[model samples]
Target: MADGQWWRDAVIYQVHPRSFADSNGDGVGDLNGVRSRLPHLRDLGVDAVWLSPFYVSPQADGGYDVADYRAVDPLFGTPADAEALIADAHALGLRVLVDLVPNHSSDRHDWFRRAPAGGPGSPARDRYHFRPGRGARGELPPNDWHSLFGGPAWTRAADPDGSPGDWYLHLFAPEQPDFNWANPEVAEEFRAILRFWPVRGVDGFRVDVAHGLVKAEGLPDHGRSARLLDLTSTPFWDQDGVHEVYRDWRRLLDSYPGERIGVAEAWGRTPVRTANYVRPDELHQAFNFHHLTCSWEPAALRAVVDDSLAAMRAVGAPATWLLSNHDVVRHATRLAPGADRARAATLLMLALPGSAYLYQGEELGLPEVVDLPDASRRDPAFRRTGGRDGHRDGCRVPLPWHGDRPPYGFGPAGGPSRLPQPDDWAELSAAAQDGVPGSTLELYRAALAPRRAHPALGGGDDLVWLPGDDAVLAFERGAGDEVLRCAANAGGHPVEVEVGPAGELLLSSAPVDHDGAHVVLPPDTAIWWIPARAPRAAPASAPAPASTPMAAQTPTRSSTSALGPPPP
Candidate 1:
């Protein structure tokens, strides 16, 4: 609500450091590359850049497996380079947020090495989730809750003294053992870790797997263990006391005035459960992933949006929205008719209230790369799940930088790269789209700029779907003079409707023609209306055919809306 609260209506761009750009001819992206690209991000007009984990990591889990919470990973850049990038980003009027993986660390970390196999008397033994009689030689840990990456979550290891004695729980990978948040030492360590970046001017953290920070008291075998032998417990996630941990971090974050923000990645839980992690003293916002997982039906979209909002309001916390991320199939492929559908979805995402996160390449309307080699896979989920879907590597592919050379859109190499570069840079390069009107990139900028400019559009009341042609998804944002009506055609066919005498188009994804109370919306388009100052004359054309309701209209709203449905 305050000007200082920039994050309330901010658009966050997620960058996977290794794939963003490469400055020194190495295949992977580096700090210098990202620093060099600050102007592009600034031009794009995003409020903040949410850089994925760059802390010293083993590259297991794509940097989620932290070895040093404060140092920069060599693959990314030096600590000094990171500081410079932060300064550059700030100078460009962009806020920088780093990924914090307090949940675990690389097993190769000094602490992990001290514990080795969770052996007795190891200083790091208690740093992770360890259970008795679960060593590599002993029977596996007794739970069946599958890892997010697939397979069992338990991994056997030797003690620091080379003694064989224990097993540790890894919700995602063996390298990322679950941190024992129950331990005061661990909590303090994380607090210190958080302060490290903020001291260097990092705005905040996008906390990794926030809900999975703690586990259940007893390591009981989750009933599904027979099928998932590697897991230790089902109740291990979203356990009690997580809020206490987050509340502690919230306090730490408050030490800095303004700029500080926190968003939690709370997958696998209802918005209610997710909201619990975002209370006043907890996370500033928790991700609402319902839209990403839902089908392209109006009813489905409306229900999820309503539910997610209600959940957030009930908990007195803010919500964040996302359509695609490194872990899921690109929204383009996830929707019907692919990119066109994704464009419509993006319009809805921006029009709704809350903080929005745009994944790199999403604005380019890039489709998921279905063709990927098994050897080139980056997501362990596919490996553990027998490849039900290809690994996330396809979605995490390199971004083309206006050149049709090596490394596709990434890296400094000149020829034949890891992923073949696309033939046309014009279609995807930031430079190519910056000045082109109606380009996906431009549209994204337009979509977000309005929200940033108008507070009424970023935070508001419940989005109530106006009853009319079910083909169009329409709702009112805010109240009184600030109330803006946003309507979009979620279907492939065109929609024409009455806009009430006072309505005037504020924004639209599709072409709009209005006369008096009647408004015509082209196929797959949108129109935003503000309460008109006075009544207008009527149009000459007749309204479109009112097809019998095949289904209910969908009124999707952001989770942060003061009023809305609860997330399912």
Candidate 2:
């Protein structure tokens, strides 16, 4: 979107603001905290930083329920702080992406607060889905749609005369009332919001609930009391009208300078349907939840990767791959008892030809805080589901920056952290692994180095999968000296992968033994090997240095994985 396809291959870091860092000893991450940490992202070699929601909110859904699109929440910071942070990020050569929640708004939002008071048929109430109940006394909900977070999607509202009134639609929590996209005012308001940030140097937006903006013609039943955690389409999600909303947004983004873009958080049931959100006339990209939810098996991983690329390519869009995010279990714990498999998965995601997303603390090899005390949990979904679903708090704990105690260097000592920290994280702090050999932090840094320096890993390459067993995946990119070959062993036993006879090993997720033609890859290990570069020929006008030897043609592959992790 930025004149060329810079985002197509970018390594963008997702910063869960509340858990990223606490500035002013406030126990919550604000814009200034992120600004202070901009250098860490720059030094980490990522091209952009995608910040989670910090807009004015009641924290009912962790800032996803916006009370005001143009204002920053007082709990986080001021508008000035956000502007300064954007300026600071650009100064550090990093682009910034802010979250935009378009599907719903906090019930406290101005328009929503006035909806019930405006009565059922009033224009003010028309902005949102305020409809009459279905029963004889208007006591039943309009439809049986359930909230994505849990419970019924419909919530009864009070009338202007203080009598029982209409029911409003909320796909998430009751505090978040879904807007009526069919209302012209709804689309017009978002158009203004789409223009608000890009003019202030904000690079793009990560649109939340992109596909759920429009529901089916009538408030039809979804056939479930609570929607299961699957990407299946329903009457309330991924409807056809959602694409029309994005096409309008895409047009607005194109009108601005600096390649402003929009990334959809759409959950289409199939890859082809998902691709529709990223067509040239729609939004620029969409998150690939398929990869995030993929298992630790080679066949499943290959299927997702192949399907993602094929579908995205068909629509002339770049595929996005990621292993971790704030809402899911961290791969470290998901692929545990050791970090080997998670580390390998990170390498595999980076090796694939597309944009990559890195969740906060992932490079430090942090596992999800699966044992957080129930009293400290703040996820609304967890609260509403009666504790049966929604375990996202485990992945949103404050990051350990340095100290060896709870709140582990996340901020000043004694700061009131919004979420508790794990004391054990001190050993896994970014400070502990900054330059440590073979550490996950170092592995990420090393992987990013070549990706930034090599053309083969750039935006234009295609992945060519090689023949391998069910437990392994092999692929190559580029041609001749620039060719980069990669293979991963995702099984329980060590494997000998035939990667080609004339390449140099650049890096691997785990230690290995290789003889050019074959690499004895350990379980859960992935490697990056490139065709060995040939020696430079002497200029026609000058002879080569006498010290230069003929044997240089067969230089050994350069690598740092030889002393890394071994098969466990």
- Top TM-score: which candidate number? 2
Give candidates' CA RMSD values in order: 7.0, 6.3
Cα misplacement distance, residue 412 of candidate 1 (Å): 3.3
- Which lDDT tens digits does candidate 2 get at residues 130-167? 88998899999998888878888889999988999999
Could you give me the TM-score of model 1 versus the true structure?
0.87
Assess each prediction's global lDDT (C-alpha) against the native. 0.70, 0.81
Model 2 scores a C-alpha lDDT of 0.81
Q: 65, model 1: CA deviation in Å? A: 1.0
Superposed model 1: Cα runs more than 4 Å off = 1-4, 121-123, 134-137, 159-163, 225-233, 405-409, 413-426, 500-503, 510-519, 534-568
Worst 10 residues of 2 by lDDT: 549-558
TM-scores of all models?
0.87, 0.92
